[model samples]
Target: MSAAWVLGKRALREGRRTPDALLPTLFIPLFFLVVNVGQAAKIFPAASTEFLHGQGYGAFQLPSSLLLAASFGTAALFLVEEIEGGYFDKLRASPVPRSAIVLGRLIAELVKAVAITTVLVLLGLAFGISIASGPVGFVLLVALTALWAVVFVGFMQIIALKTRSAAATNSAGLVFFPLLFLTPNFVPRDLLTRPMEIAATLNPVTYVMEALRSLILEDLEWGTIAPGFAVVLALGAVMLALNVRVIQRYD
Candidate 1:
């Protein structure tokens, strides 16, 4: 645990030193949020959009942006750099537990997620969006979003460990784009066409978006929010296991 903590701190420090790498993670999401809201706000004004539950279209779209922000993690890229620099080999030869190496990067991702979620939420509020679940829900929203980020970074780390290539790890991040778009980003799942609705239903990212939308557009509805947490936990478990296995077998 201590080793994981130390490594997590080191990762955080490294992130601090490379703000340029961090900007795109925040910027792209913000750009999507602004563009989506601008394009659709008129069509789905809060005054008439039942799905929005009296909130602006920005509220409905905020979760998509949050999820996008969480998906743009740099941990795997950093891992590739460590591998190429031989630092990863040094850690492997040391007394650090293999799991610590993975958890350390995830811990840093969780921290970054919290910061990114907070910034985006604040910006959402600035755009006249409000959280119906209030402050407690706000906290839960950030926690869940950050957990999803960690889960994604775990998958990316698996790629990093297996290929040990910066290019492959970066390319792997693009896979999340289709996952994001396949969800009901611009409309309610019920409102989507039959085929797209089924597609969105199968997409796990849909649950995360609905869960976050519930927090922003409605009161504390655990029935709606629990599934998002469940998905995150399940994905985190699988990703972490795979990451550790890859590291254990890494040459």
Candidate 2:
């Protein structure tokens, strides 16, 4: 078998065997979706503001939950599993191209992201959350989610390759929240605190949130979506380079 196939199968098997690995990807987003959407109206009185650039709280916060499921949650689990299983070491020693190992993990992360998004989309539909930009915008939303999964997972893999400890992986996962919360996630960008405004200005997650907001809220603004997608690709490349170096240095 090809090395990519071997590594891919390994990832698939590990994912299936550990319910914990996949369960959070399914439930955490759903839980947050329900809780946040329920409270957004009550909490963010300005959600009704047309100047905010999003429809309402539910649609506004949906991308954050989706991105969390795609990156922070599932990426942590995958890293922890690889560390616990000593699969990273095994892959390092194998004759397979290093890219195969990385690609396999990226593929696995994408699958997990898709599953999470699919479930959330169904829930959103049930709650009457339709795409504002028509069918193309809806497709872009899914594409962006998957793309973000690839880039974010690559970034996490770089951390995982260096740390090689579940505890450290967990710590690294927590690092995402500051970036996530500092953005215009629940509240609109116009209502952000000064510190939050600065943080959101620097955060790549903000770009993604903005892009998703544009699509789902029927606000077809390429100015918002393009930068987010571009940054995702740019960051992915840097992370992939770091991952390659870490793997090469693996003892």
Candidate 3:
């Protein structure tokens, strides 16, 4: 655990020094939030949109933006850098446990997620959005978002470890775009076409988005919220296990 902590701190320090690496992670999402709200705010005004629960379209769309922000993690890219520079090999040969290597990166991702989620939430508030579940929901929202980020970064790390190529690792992140759009980003799931609805239902990301949307547009709906956390936990377990196994077997 101590070794993991040290490596996590190191990752945080490196991230701090390379703020440029985070610009896209932050900007693209914020841009999407602004653009989506601008384009759809009138069509789905808070006064009329049944699904929005009296909140503007921004509130409904905020979760999608939050998920998008979490998806743009750079941990795997950094891991690729380390691999290329030979530092990762040194760590593998050292006394540090393989699990710590993976945990350390995830720890850094949790911190990053918290900061990004806070910023997006504040921005959402400024745009006339509020958490219907209030302070408690706010806490859960941050926790869930951070957990998703850690899980996502873990998956990205798997790509980094398996491919050992920065370009492939970075490019693979684009696959999330389809996952993002397949969800009910602009409206409720029932409103989607039959085919689209089925696809959204199958996409685990949909549950996470709805869980976040529930927090913003309605009060604590445990039924809605539970599924999001469940998906994150299940996905996190798989991603973490795969990450550790990949690192352990890496030549």
Candidate 4:
């Protein structure tokens, strides 16, 4: 446990040293938020009357922005660097548990994800996107965002350990772009076409989006939030288990 803590600290130190790599996690969300909200405001009165459930588009899209910001990670970049440089071999030779190495970095990523989520949520509030469930909903947003980020990390860990190539691991994040958008990102699920509805139903991201959106638009809709938790857990468990197996194989 102490070894994991130390490695977690190391992961944070590396992130602090290379802010450029981490900045996009925050930047992409803010950039899109501004553009989307700006476009929405121009048509607010009319658009709100449609499928928004009587809310502005900013509130509708804020969860997606937070999701994007919190979901980006290094995808075991530092671990790959250490492996290439032979530093990781030295650590592997130590008595520390193999899983600690991956879990430690993932823990750091979750902390960073929480920070990003908090900042984006605050920014959303500043821009007039209110949470219907108030303080409790805001807290739920942070927790859900962190869990979502952890889910991404589980998948990235699999890629990082299996490929151990910086290029391949780094590009792993590209998968998220499509997963996020193929669902009800820009619009509500009710407005989605038949094909999109079919895809979204099968896609866990759709539930995630709906969960976060419910927090923003409705008061503690347990029906909406519970499915998100289930999807995240079910997916994260499988991905994390795969990573553990990969680590055992290479260790």
Candidate 5:
């Protein structure tokens, strides 16, 4: 555990110090936030706009950026480079536990994910977005976002371990995020078309979005918040276990 902390700190530092790590993750969601809101506001109904007055369209779609951007950790990308350079083998030869290797990278990604989310949240606030749940909801927002990011870290690392290929690791999110975009990304689930509404109802990302939307756009209700964390927690555990096993069984 001590070694894991040490590695975790080092991993975190590496992530922080690298500008590239922040750029790609930060750019996408932020870009989407601005673009989506800019276009949607022009065409959206006044009642809908009035309904989301505090954060407006930006606040409502804020999770689109928050959840999507923070969710993709470059841990796998780093692992790929390390594996190619033989540093991964050196770590394997070291006394650090296998779980530490995986968890350490995960910790680093979590830190990065949270940092990115915080910056974006602050940026949203700068544009007049308010936190619906106040201080407490802000904390929950960060934690829940980090939990979701952790799940992604596990999935990405599994790709890193099994394929050990930069190409494969980088493409992991490509396979998973379409469903996220298809969810109530542009509007509330209730506002979605019938087929899309049904899809959003079934999508876990919808719960994650509504959970976050509650903090920024709606009243914070356990009814909304709890389910998001519950789903992420349940899913995060499975991803964590699978990544741990992959690491433990690695040759």
Candidate 6:
């Protein structure tokens, strides 16, 4: 336990030293938020009246923006860095349990994810977006966003450890892009074409969008949020198991 805390603290310190590593996690998402919101604003008002449950497009899209901001980049970047720099080997040689190292890294990523979400959420409010779901919804947004970060980290750790290359890990992170686009994010799922509709139906990110939209624009719709959280938790378990297998194989 003490060892895990030490590892997590060390990871946080290391992250602080390299602002470049943290910048994309915040900047890229902000760029997307600005571009998407601006380009869609003209038409979004008309479209929002049809299926937005009486919310503006800016409000509808804010949750997706927050999620993107919190979710960009990989905790695997750190893993790959440590491995290439030989720091991972040094840690592996220590007497600490292997799982502790990964857990510590996961904890650090969760912290960072929450911080990013907070900043973006504040920005969303600054832009006049309001959370209709109130306190419960706000808490769930934060909680689920943190889980999203940790779940992605679990997958990232698998890729980083299995490939042992920072470049490869970075490339692997792009796989989420298609997943993000296929979701009911920018537009209502009802408005999507056949192929996109099918893809969005199958995409886990769609549920996340639904959950966030429900919270940000609706009145505490527990039905959508519950299943959305279930999906995140289930994915987190699966990815964690996969990462654990990788750690056992390599460590």
Ranked by lDDT, the better of candidates 3 and 6 is: 3
- In order, candidate lDDTs are 0.92, 0.74, 0.91, 0.82, 0.82, 0.81
Question: Cα RMSD for candidate 3?
Answer: 0.8
Q: How many backbone clashes does candidate 4 have?
A: 0
Name the runs in model 5 displaced over 4 angstroms: 45-54
TM-score of each: 0.98, 0.88, 0.98, 0.93, 0.94, 0.94
* Per-candidate RMSD, Å: 0.8, 2.6, 0.8, 1.8, 1.7, 1.7
* Number of clashes found in candidate 3: 0
The candidate that wins on lDDT is 1
Q: In angstroms, how far off is 192's CA in candidate 6?
A: 1.4
Model 3 weakest lDDT span, ten residues long? 45-54
Per-residue CA lDDT of candidate 2, range 54-139, in tens? Answer: 45567777888888777664554576576678866676677887777777777766776666677786688678677787788877
lDDT winner between 1 and 4, please give it: 1
lDDT string, candidate 4, 1-251, tens digits: 78878998888888899989888888888998888878765665534456456667888888888888766667477777787889878888889988788878877887888888988888888877788878998888888888888888778777877787889888987898889888898777777898988888888888988999999888999999999888888887887778767777895
Evaluation by TM-score, superior candidate among 3 and 4: 3
Candidate 5 is scored at a TM of: 0.94
* Candidate 3, residue 140: lDDT: 91
What's the lDDT for candidate 6? 0.81
Winner on TM-score (2 vs 6): 6
Off by over 4 Å in 6: 46-48
